[model samples]
Target chain A: MVEQGGGASGAGCMGCPLRQRSEWCVLNEEETRFLSRHLKKRRYRAGETIFSAGEPSHGVYCVASGTAAIRKGNAEGNTVLLRLAYPGDTLGYRGLLLGENRRYGAEALGPSKVCFVDRAVVKLLLERNPALGQQFLRRIARDMDEAHDHLVRNATLSNRDKFIHLLRALMNRHGRTATDGGHFMELPLSRRDLASMIGARHETLSRIIGRLEEDGIARFSGRTVYVARSHWLLNDSRPPTLLD
Target chain B: MVEQGGGASGAGCMGCPLRQRSEWCVLNEEETRFLSRHLKKRRYRAGETIFSAGEPSHGVYCVASGTAAIRKGNAEGNTVLLRLAYPGDTLGYRGLLLGENRRYGAEALGPSKVCFVDRAVVKLLLERNPALGQQFLRRIARDMDEAHDHLVRNATLSNRDKFIHLLRALMNRHGRTATDGGHFMELPLSRRDLASMIGARHETLSRIIGRLEEDGIARFSGRTVYVARSHWLLNDSRPPTLLD
Candidate 1:
């Protein structure tokens, strides 16, 4: 369920942490002021639906904190995890711009904060600011490029290579250095969710994890994964071969 | 090899068929005239590289006729066909927008004609025309949506179902109705290219095609696929099961 937070009056976009991110659009003073006046903050608990498939989007959301999963269900009644949204990422703008219903559902992967801006305001801002529109184009283009990469990986990579790639991504996004010169991070998603992200069966994912443990490359305790050799995880071009 | 064609002097954006496409951007007379002044046409033979991966894009390409394959090489050195660009589709805008090297290579799937516009001209037109920029945003958004759909299908669909989905797509794009109420089309891609597009091994794809022929669902004759039941191919939610 959406927990309605205070409007932009409490904490506005003027000094938001997202502005520090390179991907965030640069807004002129007048545009920023106008945007701040129209923004509303919303919070969601883990597993809460931020938006659903087929829903009409009247506004776009900015991920102010935490992560969200973008997913869709296929004809077979199985859900596929398309990608994860991180801080500073905008959602629903695609549907809004295309004037179509949402193509996928977005859910809070954990406790997350998102800021919403209405359709009219977003349109007005883009019309008045070419820089913002160009920035959006660049961001969407980068997204398309990543999507192409994901398609290639899905088509060509072995399951073990795919898992390693996913781990490398997770470490880059969320892992931290530990006292043992390793990388440590609480898994942002459940093992089941991870399985869906990597396009592996639950049993296959479990077997891969077991093999990783036996190889002493990574250790998983509860929902946390510890990479003993962080550099190897990050830089190794050749993934360790698995007997599975 | 790129065969340089006559400049925009021969024929221009004015009355160009691409302008009729709903996906193409709406341009004012001034904008169209400005664009035409800068466009240069290039022709490519089948299997010719339109643009190589890692090349810096100084501008964008507009597909005037025929088809092109967008592809990228994976870590294992196998090329993955990312997607196909048909007539009226714009290419390289993503790389141009990000000011980055091309993330993938594009090649002519058949004899094709393409129009090129330089970066400065494109930037000038976009700056002077907000409608053009907005239309690009919409197009990129649609592309992103399709990419997400591709990701989901790759994850969940069985190989047979995937082949059926591909056939349905091809039928929609290039199929012709036969007198007997069937759909027939020359395959835009060779069997090897189709295998790469669908992420199947060459042998696996051959087996699938053989099965498709035996089931009386689709018939492959050299470089063409004829579907006896066009409506079934398009609307059948339940894919025929195959004994692999």
Candidate 2:
């Protein structure tokens, strides 16, 4: 991995684990060489708002390292977390397609490095190089698929299923270790944040977590939570049409 | 409106109100002349599936002169209706961008005349005729706005809210009659179809409709549903997350 450069115009970061691992960050040597010239690396501390929902958007963000959550705020001051973006995930393109300032706020979970590529650079790379664009497009589609799944959960899944799904999603996105007798995922969200992330009231969230812990499906300490068994949670309850 | 002079296409139903006033099909004499070469029209009877969810999506579609319903199906042979599309509305581009089959299905509610444009021709037009492409892109963004709002409802709103939103959306899209008593809009869906459209079971749909009529928001006669009190149903339930 090249470590001598640390700015937007640097033609390095090639063969770095971060670069090689992410499906969204699958740039080859030449492609990495091309992008590093256009990508400026920026850092954000925990709880820092990277971008607001209505700010003018220019570049697409790729998480080089660290964690961030995308959320939307309502008039009642209620906040809903959209997703926790991790290394290799691209932030803000879905909003960019809608126009002008985005309609969601993104905030860093902890110390995080993000690479910003100007939208023009992204368009050029997508149009000029079909293969690279294909990779990016595939990633976008996957993001969209996840978003649609979220839609279904919000519509159909029970609260318990929502909680389980939320954990499963985070584990899928950023689980760093399959520890002995259990798994450990390095996620960056507090209980309140998790409630917002899954669209549950804080009290409701607490009950669900307590229920899970009592049943040994989960355990939590600090910001980390563990599941002793996951698959069994499927039968706790299924999603319901509450209005009915 | 010029009677097409030399070339001829999409002229089977000339007196249709939707065709006459379609925002997307407002081609003047010369513009119609320019577009005639690229237009192809197809007709389908009532209850016909125009396209399925997983078929190769070739190009964008517009209702030249008919009503169509956008729907989706799950593994249980259950269908979910997304929206009822009419003249001036474009479908399939979202799938086209994803380079996959459409996420929803479209079926004819009546004998319908639909228009088609070649994807290659659309690409050429976007490339060689930038203004047209920009106009089309704006239209695409607007369509996506509707989709996004629907997604927000799917995410945040309850099932009753979802039904109210769906009714209001129909009025906005295909509204026709408004008397002093209550506004009248053509009901384009069967009760089962309405259930699918709002992701509810049929009995649940019956109960909601029964209640909506009881609440004086809407009344249904045959296939036509008259919705007069739309302000609250349309504006009140919108989640603040969307405003963000």
Candidate 3:
């Protein structure tokens, strides 16, 4: 279930932390004011559904805080965690732009807040501001690049290596560097979600975690993962391409 | 190796069949004229590299004919076929938009032709044509949606089911309706490429193909696959979502 938060005012948008992001930063003062007038804030608790698969997309959601899991469910009743949406990330725009029903469901992994802009409002804004449309294009292109990377890693990486890569990716996104030269972060996803994200079985992930613990590579306590030697996670990781 | 073909003249864009597609069709006459003036055509022999991973993307390629495989190579030297590009599909735009080196390489699956639009030219066109930018956004969004679908299938479908889905998808894209009520399509990919596309070993894929032949569902002839009962391929496939 979701709780409707107070509507964001034009002033709110002007001061929004997300405004610093390239996608939002490009919006002019007038455009920001127009968007804020239609923006609705929704708060979801942990495990609450933000949207469901097959639902008609009415608008786009931009995560205001916390993380959400984008999941796809199959006929076998299994769910695959396609990716995670963090603060400043937008969702549902793909369906809106393509005029298709939602192909996947999104759920809040923890207490989170998101801002919604109706489809019609987005269209109107894009028509008035071409810069906004181009920014969206760039954002989607970046997403496509990441999706390709994920597809390749899924097909080629060993289960252990995938886990390490996932950890490193998450760390890069949210980890706090420690004086001990390690990194610490609270995992937003549950164990099952993590397994789904890496396309591994729950039991298999548990076994891998146990091995990591034995090797002092990482420690899991509650919802937190502490990397003892972050560099170790890079071992066996795909080498950077020459261009990189 | 790449071979330069005749440069497309402005008049060519006016009559190009691809212009009928939504992405290109959105281009106004003036925009088409501008694009044609800058578009260069290139031809590739079967198995020739169009672009390699880590290369700087100078521009985008729009397939004119035949197919190309988008592939990713790992440190272990194993390659994963991410997807196939058919006629009217655009490539390399992701890296161009993100200002990153190409994350994956693309190879011609057969003798093929592609039209190239330089980065500077595209940017100028987009700056002059807001509709063109919006159309590109829609195109990228559709691609992202498909990538999500592929990821979900990879995570949830069994190997046999995945193969069936892949066959059905290809058939939908390129198959010819047959008098026998079955669809016949030449497989653009080699057996090795097919195995990589489905994230399976060549031996495993061969075994599965043998089983399909024994079951009388699909027949393999050289590089072609004939579905004796097309509907049978839908068995065990993911049910269409309520929205679909």
User: DockQ, in order, for the candidates?
Assistant: 0.78, 0.24, 0.64
State candidate 3's DockQ: 0.64
Model 2 residue A152 CA deviation in Å: 3.0
CA shift of B105, model 1, Å: 1.3
Better-scoring candidate (DockQ), 1 or 3: 1
lDDT of 3 by residue, A1-244 (tens): 2333324443567777877873767888888877776778888889999999999999999898888989998767899998899888889888898787998889898889888888998889888877787688888888887887788778777777888888888888879988898899988777888888888888999998887777667888987888865454455533331233
Q: Which RMSD values do the candidates have, in order? A: 3.2, 6.5, 5.1
Docking quality tier of model 1 = medium
TM-score of each: 0.91, 0.75, 0.87
TM-score preference between candidates 1 and 2, better one: 1
**Share of native interface contacts present in candidate 3:** 0.75
Misplaced by over 4 Å in model 1 are: A1-11, A22-25, A234-244, B1-11, B22-25, B234-244
Interface RMSD per candidate (angstroms): 1.1, 3.9, 1.3
Best by lDDT: 3
Runs in model 3 deviating more than 4 A are A1-11, A177-179, A230-233, A237-244, B1-11, B177-179, B230-233, B237-244
**DockQ pick, better of 1 and 2:** 1
Instruction: Sort every candidate by TM-score, greatest first.
Output: 1, 3, 2
* TM-score of model 3 (first chain only): 0.90
